[model samples]
Target chain A: MNPNGQNAETRDGCAAKLDVCGLDLYYADFQALKNIDFRLARHEVAALIGPSGCGKSTFIRVLNRMNDLIPSCRVSGKVMLDGEDIYGAMDVTELRSRVGMVFQKPNPFAMSVFDNVAYGKRMRGLRDKRQLAEVVEVSLTKAALWDEVKDRLKKSALSLSGGQQQRLCIARSIAMQPEIILMDEPTSALDPIATGRIEELIGELKKDYSIIIVTHAMHQASRVSDRTAFFLLGELIEFGDTREVFTNPVDKRTEDYISGRFG
Target chain B: MKKRVFLDGLLYGIMALSLCGVIAVLGYILVYIFRQAAGSLSFGFIFRSAREGGILPMVVTTLYVVVVSIAISLPVGIGTAVFLTEYSGNSSLVRILRVAIETLAGIPSIIYGLFGLLMFCRFLGFGQSIIAGAFTLSIMILPVIIRTTEEALKSVPVSFREGSLSLGTTKSQTIFHVVLPSALGGIVTSAILAIGRVVGESAPVLLTVGLSRNIPRTVFESGRTLTIHLYYLTNEAVNPDDFGIAFATAGTLVMVVVAINTLTKILTRKFKNSQGDAS
Candidate 1:
């Protein structure tokens, strides 16, 4: 914690819950992340703020090994969660189960509303009808969508509005019971009202799960995240509590970015 | 705008007139064949082969050849399409495969027949057998199946794949579960088109299978398809009876094609309804 009652960089005050040490990522000839170091505490919502093409999404994707699918992508260094090195001899499947992701756009399966929420459980081989039903109800409730769709569980997920679909995607991630959820501009495609709903959902979600989000919206970072990390040119420029970083940023790049002085 | 509209209408008129000419030719052929053969299309005429033999056996042989050819070609062609469209990485090899497939598609059916006759029949010592004809037809239709299925698979949206992957499902599972189901309509349509091509083929069957008006009780035996029967009858008519049999056989072939089209439409509708419900 800081003089402003906010967590600061360069101390184990939050005990280094997720330590990204000397991380470097590359896409073929393009170096995306350059020797980055950052950390996230348990049950903390850390917002990554940067302009377009600054490698924020690339950095978060490294957490779940999603970037490995790209043929020319290469990652090095350590991403440790609770003292366990995530990239060291750990099964990718097991790693993904602990760390889930939500894309910028909502991607509900071409399935019914009920099945959309039940997908992860079914993928893990849960076949009991009653158990799936209970899981759907609980997850949807947590996502603030249970009442709106309780009567139409069998309806196509595509029939829902944009906001509802995004919430449904969040519900889907929640149903997997992951310890950490990575969101890549999850509300950028949404309207203000919808964005507000997701912000409320994220605030509630952080009580139980750690969240790392990349956003272009600075106000959103200030309102929703517990801490904020400002990035520029594939490097971490500042990492501190949301209020302190927004009100009193240390790095010149961070202050410039927050003040709308150019990306 | 007015000139462009006039030009568009003129092109549309020319196209429709050309298509109508084709339909008129087909209609005239049907009417002529029916007028000549309707009297001879009796139970005995159909259930029986040539007065030299019964047409029943010939009809059975055509069915056998078509069924066997479809059985062998459907799985292999589909597998090839899936591999080319989905599994193959973007490399010079895949480009070479695309080029090879295009070349195979352009090759004439007669070339396939000649190759089959020389290779499958002569080398395997199964000269003029139904299996020889089936192998020939399978290769001739291979390009059709591969091209159509590849197009169908490509028509599925990439968003469906991304959604499945985000859920942590593997690539194979996403393809099998989501992509294949969405492309089902186009796949069945392609299969029906292949069947139409197979049923109407005459020259290839003649060159490979030979003209035997006998039922193929075994795949290794020589037999004749309906088109081949019609061809031989038109060429070698010892009596007016043979001519009538050819007309009636042509009518039966047209009927078979129509029936296949109707069946495919019904199947596609049922599938769409079920998929809509599932989603």
Candidate 2:
């Protein structure tokens, strides 16, 4: 099964949708991610959980090369997206478009709701009015926000509530029709109800897109993700089915961290 | 408690007195000017030629200077500011440019008059015309516009840039579509401030734009601005009645500046409200 699966997923493909091998990230002298090997299959949800400064955010940023914006940031090892090296021969903008990101804080551009949802496509030079309208409607609907925002499409995105704004951010990502979506603490800034709504949206989204989320909540990881990877001090300590990782004994640190001993 | 209350009351009383004192001084100037101009501020005095007691030539010349100088300087100033704030980050060249701009802003207006007289009037052979004055005033206001616009661009939130970029837009596109539009209000405010400076400046206008009383028909022809006309009216007055004309000219200058500032404020408010980016 291993050889046949690896052979079939060899060319122009990953063993999973994304494959990272011995990834090391650095910010000048600081080693942010020491060495990480991770994988995400198609149409699945993977949650990255750890304490603060555990490099979960940095790890996902490398997936889309978002760290390229920081002057002092550097990375090594292979990050393969559909079997293509993200750091070699691939344009940063193209990589970003294929793997869209959502920040912890809802960052909808200070434009109308229609413009905000259509921002990704518009930036890529999609200017046809009817096409843009359709994309906006579909993306918003998929993010479960079209009904809430339909009447106010011309209103400023900033006028929406915090949860709705977050959903708009999700819609903005989905508008790109990305192969994978990276969410960095997407709901850490939201209230409980907003967080629950996002967690539910993630459940709906995984059926269509490979989703990677970095979360602080233990239950969010257990409830939303099929696979959970516990990171500690930039090292991947445990990776397996979310149920098994949560319930059974794994490494001491993973067990201790999950049992509320220490992060 | 009583001592603290009494001291706080005294402090506020002193501040209020200072504010009233400032307003009283301004009010006194306006009252005195309006009284002096009562005899000279009729429509005929404004519509007739300078030879026939009207200052229409000066008014036209002032308009030319404001419009031409703003047209030349506004784009250059905004471009330089965008480069400084959005592109150059914290390089040594940028540091030097920032220092140079600060020095330019701090130089005395009389010095600018001397430089303009040498550079535009004699060296460039514009020869003390409205064109010369417009060039000088354009240079004079560059620092003011650049400094204010850079501040405006910096005030745009970091999240706006991140939001635009993470969606796969180029850096320049992010700046133009998101950051620049967000900073438009501040840029307009900067331009208004430059207009105020250009309107109030007298020495530079007097040096580069000559005190010609003729209604000059072209920018190349020598003409006098309102500030220069007012200066000449005050300097060469032979009769007490002549002083009335100077007062009227001053009043006209005041009205023009007030009208420009008010009109722009209303216009920009409407613009920002329509775009829904003011907040």
Candidate 3:
């Protein structure tokens, strides 16, 4: 939390969409995240920037309990989404529906393009065909991929280019109407052109959804996010507005990382 | 360098000789069977009743055991595999089940024959019928289905599971929509292997499946499979014609296996194409 309490205060004076306090995660005996306090207001893109194994990916996964898949993973902390304890009271499936995620790799289900986008709604029991079609269209259009895929919605999603596949993943996330979308290095596997397209998509996505992206590229965080949090060796080194964090980091480690010094 | 080259040439010659030995034995059996079966390899011999020098009843019984055994085992085997791969995480029960499956696969067919005779035929009172034999064969093939399906499930990428779960699909739904579909090719291969085992086993069939020569109208009726009929014919051959019929039965079993192999390959290709569209 900032000294001025601005981090917790939203423009609308509502509770922060996400308020994470005193979070410490462990995998068996090995701690993966140190005590960290964070808060996210509505419609803000908060980018997590760190080197490899610095827990940026792990932190984003914490938001949706994706780490629950790991048998050894253990988490302690208050991860409250809209003032509800996600780890305590909310059902895992319900929590995930409200907090969508895009992985580091574009993992479109092995199905038709239309089916990939409609998977979430279908699983949630929306059996009406017209409703599903409408959701798919709206989601794809929001993800900035409708024009490229509208004609070939029946084609296999695997048939798309790597960049298009990433967009399709974003569209898949959007179809669920999640309040927050956590992206774990969503474009790290793509070419520069694809990465640029995703960056632009992230900018447009923040208008409707709270976006938290984990990226190894500092330039990407500087370019895409409104707030940037720098992590170092499982500890959060700095958290502030993206422009200020890039221009004048309070922590020495954050300055060293952003200045292209050793990570 | 010259000596190493000579050794390499010598090793290659030995491998080539071994390959030829395998091909020679296979070719010799096929040619000898075709020659000996010349008198009985007709359409009538295959389609007529046993009293009329045909093996139609045996063929029908063989198919019954194959179909019924597969139907009984495929789901159970796949379920065991899913439990091992998806739900049971590093538990000793999974390890024990794996070891049990491995041991069962190595057990002698005669032991299964005796067990089936006691359990299904006498105790359960199904009494030396097609159902009894199918039940016995289904148990015999469970290890094959479980092992192959386990491998198939493990081979599907972890990312697929994560992707599905992230969409708020339950574990079972993720399995149904992504994991199993991704592993469909392997599951089909396991079923084919189980079919191979069901078609080839004669000792167990002889114990549970009776030596009835008539076509079975129901699973409760006593019947003989093609392998069992071939065994009986070979054991009681008193004339050249009898020997001819025995060899013809062997030839027919081979034909059936080949036909099934071709049929499944075509069906699996179609299934793969359909899965791409529907999933």
Candidates in order have lDDT scores of: 0.83, 0.89, 0.91
Tens-place lDDT per residue, model 3, B165-211, is 99888999999988998898899999999999999998999999989
Model 1 lDDT at residue A218: 92
Q: What are the per-model numbers of colliding residue pairs?
A: 6, 0, 0
Q: Tens-digit lDDT track for model 2 on B1-279? A: 999999999999999999999999999999998899999998787778988989888888887888889999999999999999888879898899899999999998888888989999999999989898889999999999999999999999988888788899999989988898889889889989999999889998888888888888889988988888898889999998999999999988887788888888898777656665312
lDDT per residue (tens digit) for residues A106-176 in model 1: 87876788878887777778899889999999999999999999988888888999999999988888888
Expressed as tens digits, the lDDT of each residue in A53-80 for candidate 2 is 9999999989988788788998999999
Question: Largest TM-score belongs to which candidate?
Answer: 3
lDDT of 3 by residue, A1-263 (tens): 33134444753346689988899999999999999888888888899998899999899999999999998999998999999999997999999999999999999988889989998888889989888999999999999999999988888899999999999999999999999999999998999999999999998898788899999888999999889999988998888889999998899888888898886
Name the top lDDT candidate. 3
Q: CA lDDT of A80 in candidate 3?
A: 93
Candidate 2 accuracy as lDDT: 0.89
Best by DockQ: 3
Model 2 spans with C-alpha error above 4 angstroms:
A1-15, B1-32, B42-48, B238-240, B273-279
What TM-score does prediction 2 earn? 0.91
Cα RMSD over interface residues, candidate 2: 3.0
* DockQ by candidate, in order: 0.31, 0.49, 0.59
